[model samples]
Target: MAIDITVDHAVATLTDGTQLRTPFWRIDSDRDGHHLAMLAAQHGNEVQGIEVARRFADLCAEQLVAGTVTLVPYANLLAIRHRRHSSDLGPEQPGRESQGFNMQQAWPGDPDGNDIERVVYALDAKVIAHSDRLVDMHCWNHFWAAAVLARSDNGVAVQMAEATDLPFVMWRNSPAPEADIATSSHLMYSRGGVSMAIELSGQYQMREAEVDRGLRAMANVAKVLDMIPGEPEIIDGPMLEPLAGNDVVVEAPCSGIFMQSGLEPGQRVVQGLKLGHIVRDDDLETVVVRSPACGRLWKYGRHDMKCDVRLPDQHPYASEGDMLALIVQACGPERE
Candidate 1:
C-alpha cells in the first residue's frame, strides 16, 4: 500500500529578523496505529542522529506497514549551522549563560521568547505535541559507547530502550522537576507518552559505524512499534543504574597530557583499578588515574574542553580535577 507523506516547515523569526525554518517529514501508512516521532540535532554538534532521522524517514516511505512517523532531522537549525552545541545569537540570560541557546533545554518553549525558545516552541506545538512516542537522538564523546537513556518507571519507555539493542541502557527513576524539564523526551514522558533518548558515540562529524548503529536502533524501534514488520532484536548487555550519590569519576590529579591504560568504555573494572596516567607538564611528574569503585566504565577522555569537532590525532590534555573516566554501577534484573 502507498503511504501518505507530508513535508512542512516549522517557522520562527529570530530577534535579528532572520527567519528560522526547520523542515519536518510526516509519513502515514494506510492503516493507522501509533504515532512515533524521531528528532535529531537538538545539540547542533550531534550530527549522527540527523542522519538516522533522515534515513529512517526514507525507510518508512518504502516499508511502513502501519501508523504515522514524523522525522525532524535538524531539530535545532541555528546550532547545526554554527556547528556548536547552541547558537550564540541570543543575549546571555542569567543562569543560562553556559548553555547559550540550547534547544534541548527549551522544551515546550515560549513563542515570544528568545531565538532558540521561539524555534523550540514552534517545533513543540507543530510536531512533538501531536506525537505519541518520541526518540530524541543525541551524541556523546568519542570515548563513550552508544546507549539508550530512558525513565525506569515508564514501562513503555523502558521497553523501547531495550528494543534498541544498544550495548548499554541507563535508567532514571525520579520525576523531572518542572524547572528542570529541559529535554523533549522528558516533556513527552510527562504527558504520559513513551520516550527515550539514544546517545550515539562521537559528534561534530558523522562516523559511518555510529550512523549505522543509529539506523539499526531506529529500525528496531519501528519494529517494536509495529510501524514496520518483525520483532525487536534484543542484545545482552549491562542495564546500568545510577549510583546513589554520584558516579565514580576519575579525574586528573595534575595538569598534564593524559595517557590511557588500555581500558575502554563498557569494560568492567574492580575498585582501585588503574585507568590511566597523567604526565604533569609543569614538573614532569606522573600521576596515575584509577577507578574509585567497581563498575562499568561509561566514558573516558579529557574533560572541561569544548568538543564541538572531532580530534582524531590530537592528544588529550587534562587539568587538575578534569574528568578522565566515569564508572556506572551495573544493576541486575531485580532492579527492573
Candidate 2:
C-alpha cells in the first residue's frame, strides 16, 4: 500500500510582521536515508531553480514513495508576486527597478528586517531545521551561460557534482576582489549542510536542454545520496577555481562599440590572447582587447550592445565589458 503523507503549510510571521509561508510535504517510508530539501527562486531573475523544484514536487506526487523530500519551490513570493526583485523595491527604484533585494544574500535573515530579510530568515528556519541535504538552484547572468558552484574541495558536494555531469564546477567562492559573496553558493555550505548551487542556464525562457539537464541532475543527486537506488552516469569536465582575489575586470578604457571574436562560453584562452576589439566608431578604428591571464573563458558579453562594458543589473546585449567572458585556471577531476 502507498504510504500516506502529511503536508504542512502556513505563514511564518517574521519579527517585522512580514509573513512568509513554509509549504512542505513529509512522506513516511520504509527506506532508510537522510532528509533532502530543494529550494529555488530566491532571486526573481534566476527562475530555473524554481522550475526544477516544481517538477520534482510533481514527480514525487507520482513516484516518490521513499523517504522525505521537502521543497520550497518559490521562497521569495513577494518578489515573485510583484514581479519586482524585492518586496520593498518598486519598478522605479532608479536603475535597479522595482525588483526587491536579492533574497539569497539575506541569509540568516533578521527577525526585524527588510521585507526580503524577514522572508529569508523565516524560510531558512523551516528548511534548515529539517533537511540533511540541500540543493539551491540558480541561473547565470543573462549575458553568461550556465555553471555549477560548490564549496572548495567538499566531498558531499562532490558526489552531487559527479552526478550532474555538468561542463564546469566553480570551486571556492569568487576570489575576485570585486566578487560578491551575498548571492554565493557558500551560504548553504556555511550552514554545515551538503549543498551545491546550480546554474540551470538563461533567465527568461524555458530551454528544453536546460530543463532536461536540471531534471537529470536532480535524479542523479537522488542516486548519489542513495535516496534512490541506482548508478548514475559520471560527468567528465574541467574543475575550475573561481577567479582569484587579484583577478582583473577588463573595463571599457574608452566608450565604443563592441565586436566579438566568436569566443563561446567555456572556451580557452592564454595570457595576452586577443579576446575581441572595440571600435570608437562604426569606422575601422578597431582597438584590440586582450586577455590578461592564461585560463579558459568563463563569462562574456551577450549579442546585443556595442559597448563591452555594461552597467550592473543591465539588460544583456553585446557590450564591451559586460564580462565579455570569464576565464578560469582550468584544473583536473576532483578527488572522490
Give the top-scoring candidate (TM-score): 1
In angstroms, give how far residue 21 of model 1 lies from its true place: 1.7
**How many clashing pairs does model 1 include?**
0
Off by over 4 Å in 1: 1-6, 89-100, 174-181, 235-239, 242-264, 267-296, 302-336
> How many Å off is the CA of 158 in candidate 1?
0.9
Residue-wise C-alpha lDDT for candidate 1, range 194-228, written one tens digit per residue: 88888888876788777887888898889988889
Instruction: Write one digit per residue (lDDT tens) for candidate 2, span 1-336.
Output: 444555666355765565567666555455667677777666555667666776666655555545677777677787667654455554434214434366776676666766666666667676655667877877664455456776656788777876776656766543454544454244455556677778766654566666667777777787788766677755535445455543345554444666667775545667787877777544547687787776556666534331212343443333444455566654332221
lDDT of 2: 0.61
**TM-score: model 1 vs. ground truth:** 0.77
Summed backbone clashes in each candidate are 0, 26
Residue 190 lDDT (model 2)? 53
